[model samples]
Target: MTPRPYLDITPTQLATLAPGTRLIDVREPDEFTGPLGHLPGAELVPLGTLEATLGGWARQAPLLLICRSGGRSEQAARMLARSGFRHLYNLAGGMLAVRATPVAQPQG
Candidate 1:
């Protein structure tokens, strides 16, 4: 079998995600609610239970994986790819990077 394919999305790029994009955070629920506040529509799936939640996510929309640091999310992406999911994206540096990123503001 061939290696599964996936994509990466940087923190800066994440700030610009289109409306309704599904951001699945594979981190623990506590981490998700703590500092590094999540994006508007991000959902907490947690790495341990991601497999069970995959089916419910909207496959047609862009699926972005996230975690505390990125390792778990990477694993999630691999699993999702093997399950025939397309448009899979792993947050490049996870919440650390996301927190470091500066959200752009609209200019009047």
Candidate 2:
């Protein structure tokens, strides 16, 4: 087994995600669109079903995982890293931090 790589990123750092960056929210559906709105272009892939749903995703694509708190997303990042997916990052402080800062808008 290889070492797990963990990368922590912030909202300000993500102000300009490079093209093809997959910003994913590992929170539940309700939480995604609830009081704490999700990132501009974050895809809803709740952690519970993430493994099963990731079967066809591009393993090499840049992925930014997020959750209500940083814990769950960190878990997801580790999982992907173990599965041979690199370019993984967890949103530092998660949505709670996002709520405190203006987030990046989706790029065209």
Candidate 3:
């Protein structure tokens, strides 16, 4: 099967995620804690559990996959893409990079 294209973005770009963006944290639950807090509104689906957890993903919306680093999330994104998920994005550098950027507080 042909590989699906991934929309790779820097941590700064994560600030752009709005209500419509489907943010997915592909890191393990333990890894999700500590210094780097998760992106607000992100759905947690550990990479190991992705296959069973994917049934609930919104097929229509663009999926932004994230992890401690870019590696695991990219793998997860590719798998989802192969499974017919259309819009897939890999957050380049993942949470580490995201944490480095100055976060814009969500407007109330």
My TM-score estimates for the predictions, one after another, are 0.82, 0.87, 0.83
Winner on TM-score (1 vs 2): 2
lDDT of 3: 0.84
Q: Which ten residues in a row have the lowest lDDT in candidate 3?
A: 12-21
Ranked candidates (lDDT, high to low): 2, 3, 1
Clash counts for all predictions:
0, 0, 0
Q: Compare the candidates by TM-score and give the number of the best one.
A: 2
Deviation in Å, model 3, residue 10 alpha carbon: 0.8
Error of 1 at 81 (Å): 0.3
**All predictions: root-mean-square deviation over Cα?**
2.6, 4.3, 3.6
Q: Which stretch of 10 consecutive residues in model 1 shows the poorest summed lDDT? A: 53-62
Runs in model 3 with CA error above 4 Å? 1-4, 103-108
1-108: candidate 2 lDDT, tens digit per residue = 965586898877885667889998999999999998998888999998999999998888999999987999999999898887889989989999888887468999
Best by lDDT: 2
lDDT of 3 by residue, 1-108 (tens): 965467888987766755587888988877777578798888888999999988867776788999998999999988988788888889999998887777668998
Q: Alpha carbon lDDT of residue 87, candidate 2?
A: 92
* Cα lDDT, all candidates: 0.81, 0.89, 0.84
